[model samples]
Target chain A: MVNDSELCEIILQYVKDEYLDEDDDTQIGPDSPLISSGIVDSFSMVSLKTFLERKYKISIPDAKATPEAFDSVNKIVALMKEFF
Target chain B: MAYADKIREAYRKELADIRTAGLFKEERFIHSPQAAEITVEFPSGAPQQAVINLCANNYLGLSSHPEVIRAAHEGLDSRGYGMSSVRFICGTQEIHKELERKLANFLRLDDAILYAACFDANGGVFEPFILTDQDVIIADRLVHASLVDGIRLSKALQESYKHNDMKHLERKLEEFQDKRIRLIVTDGVFSMDGDVAPLDVICALAEKYDAMVLLDDSHATGFMGRTGRGTHEMRGVLGKIDLITTTLGKGLGGASGGCVSGRAELVELCRQRARPYLFSNAIPPVVVAAANKVLELVSSTTERRDKLERNTLYWRKALTEAGLDIKAGESPIVPVMLYNAKLSQDVARDLYKEGIYVVGFFFPVVPKGAARIRTQLSASHETAHLDKAAAAFKKVGEKYGILGLKKDQIIAKFGA
Candidate 1:
């Protein structure tokens, strides 16, 4: 099972892999705002959810996937704690 | 500062943020009618130039059809310019009922109820019938904003499955079976990527779970399937779906109106209780007549749909061959992916200068990093029109050094 740090690293890596524009090179941290900072968007958020679900072997309820709950790496960690 | 001043400051800051994030929306003026070819003025409101229209929802090429225009004029003369009241309150016209009946017949459903627009039809459908707390609504996450709002007002326990993910839908259905009622809603064709929803699977899952299905076919109604019966027909799930809502503002003559077609019971209840129908003024008679005629055209001959299908297939092939990144789908909405938002905007602007009209989408509209220039094809576009549009895309993509970069390669190259 992936710990919070491992999950955060995986998420950051996945986001960098999937959601980077050619012009964008900003580094995202665990406490950095994801959705509000425009680092993750609606589409890529789904990718992140799927990635976390697959890697961590957990289900993310619809209520937990809202911007309020999954907007940052730290929040995602909190949500993971809620489920796993 | 006063509260009003603080409010203004908040609004100003939000607007500035949007601009800074490169997500501010700007509309272009069209000097001519919506068609496959149109004259659009510069954003500066300077002299307009003719360009092949590639962004309009005017599928099947009926928006400016001579017959539809003639019918509109005739309806205005025979019926009146407007209805001052809602359908039940002194606004019921024989033509309105006729259009509703024809729409129902076209979709092979028992009945259809007209709304001022499809947005209204979607808005008004849920709240009247469902006891908000007892009913559960499961929707595809990518459904139109109108449907999303409608579900919200319904007070139903709403859950969203991933867009077009049938497995997620099945899981959601299994979870919602304990609820008194289960309704699954989805768009027939997602307007952005143009990928069709998996309706056959949805119907199968709905049957297994004893749930009803609602399909918003606004993007597919006039040009999909063997007989243009919308997405249900295209996916061979016709006569299985419980409700279908569609717009006349698109493929059906590009006029302004919408309708919800379903079982007789649902239609009857919606007629009496749907707020948008009961409170809003009736659709104009001219638009009703034009929409009715458009239905006739689509139902009688498959010529227009056939042309549109050919155009879409050809354009998709051309773009694919040109090494541009596009979602591989049969629908006419072809999103040419340009990962960089600024690049997507620049490509759209350059394509416009090259006489092709399309719109660029960025973050907040679509997901971040999935920026694209969405291009829609109409049956009215000729060989020359499509060839020119494809050539313009190629020229622009080559100029920017942004072409053929697949999903995996996007971040590495553009992550800079």
Candidate 2:
């Protein structure tokens, strides 16, 4: 089971790996706003959604696929827990 | 100091609103020259190479053509680099006039005027001619952003119809029937959805309403028609459209330039009045020479166009047969539908890992809940390249549980 902190780490790793930008140190917490902070854009959000679905094998409903669930790694993990 | 802090807070709030809505965009870094296949070297050393390049506007495979390169090299030697002057000044070269003449002849238009880009061409078009409030501009709702921006900058009364909805367009025209001069503007092919406008229908509507039709054929110039003459030729209405604007950056030679081809009078008027042409430096001699060569090649041979058509049909059929949703179009721009943004992104990434280069389109670039992978077929891409891509897609579709089950099973389970 991936915990919120673990999920945050994984999400960060994915961003770092895919974007190849090692300088992004923006923290992902339960209250952090990924999109608002300019850390994630629409494309990155899609990339994150794919990561969550494939890694956790959980279906994220369209209604639930909002910033409330995906704004931060912590929120995403919490949302995944609810779905699970 | 306190006021400045408050302003910063407001800006941050607006950014927060955008973030909350999932509309922000982050640009990808491309370290290599634009080509059919490219290597994007990132900082982390996880090297990825992809095919079926989705993001480029390189419609024809002329960007890196040997003939184009040779012409560019010759121009560089003959003309010697930058002009640093506008066309009316000292910037105009023999090649500029030659390319412009070739473009006009190729499109079978009376004359043509060159610009720094298609955006500039659109930006300069409306403001110069249609300044009166009595004039009307009836534009398609889904026309390119440049056209919208151009319309906004003009004083003309602007109305828009729904995307490709001719009845709505007619209704808009009826509402503005008494206007002095009405212009119906549209994209020859919508870039995102891979859908073509009902150009023939629109042309008839223009004739009935006494409106002038202006088509931005950036996506259709070198790849739409049988002989690659564009939307007018494709629809069998070559002499009917009043104005045609297109980008040389996409299909011509993929260098960097744009042009407007139409009536001799309109072309002359634009040359004298258009700000970009009047103020901006002309296209470098090298690019103009290269573009001339490209037009010559396209006019002489239909082999490249035929190959592109065949490639488009094959990819569309194979992807659809694999049970993937593909937006319908005969053009090279093919959209493989993946409603979930994350799924689309994963598919693109996984495909990249498998050595297939494609990009996923999501919200903002596309509408929300309508994310897709916008794959573009190039005349340069071989059958083997396409086959390998399709095989990889099939493998990834099954691996990601996107399309593994039988059709009936999927329909029964998911209810279509």
Quality of model 2 by C-alpha lDDT: 0.79
Please give each candidate's TM-score. 0.86, 0.77
**What is the clash count for each candidate, in the order shown?**
1, 3
For B231-345, candidate 2 gives per-residue lDDT tens digits of 8888888888888999998888788899999989888889988887898998988888888899999999988888888988998988878877678887888987777677777
Clashing pairs in 2: A50-B342, B50-B357, B51-B357
In Å, residue B217's CA in model 1 sits off its true spot by 0.3
Which digits, one per residue and each the tens of the lDDT, describe model 1 over residues B321-341?
A: 888989888888989887777
Each candidate: what lDDT?
0.85, 0.79
Model 2 misplacement above 4 A:
A1-84, B1-32, B42-45, B48-55, B404-416
lDDT of 1: 0.85
Cα lDDT for residue A42, candidate 1: 50
- The sequence of per-residue lDDT tens digits that candidate 1 reaches over residues A1-84 is 568788778777766655554476787878888888676545336556755765677877767689878787788888898887
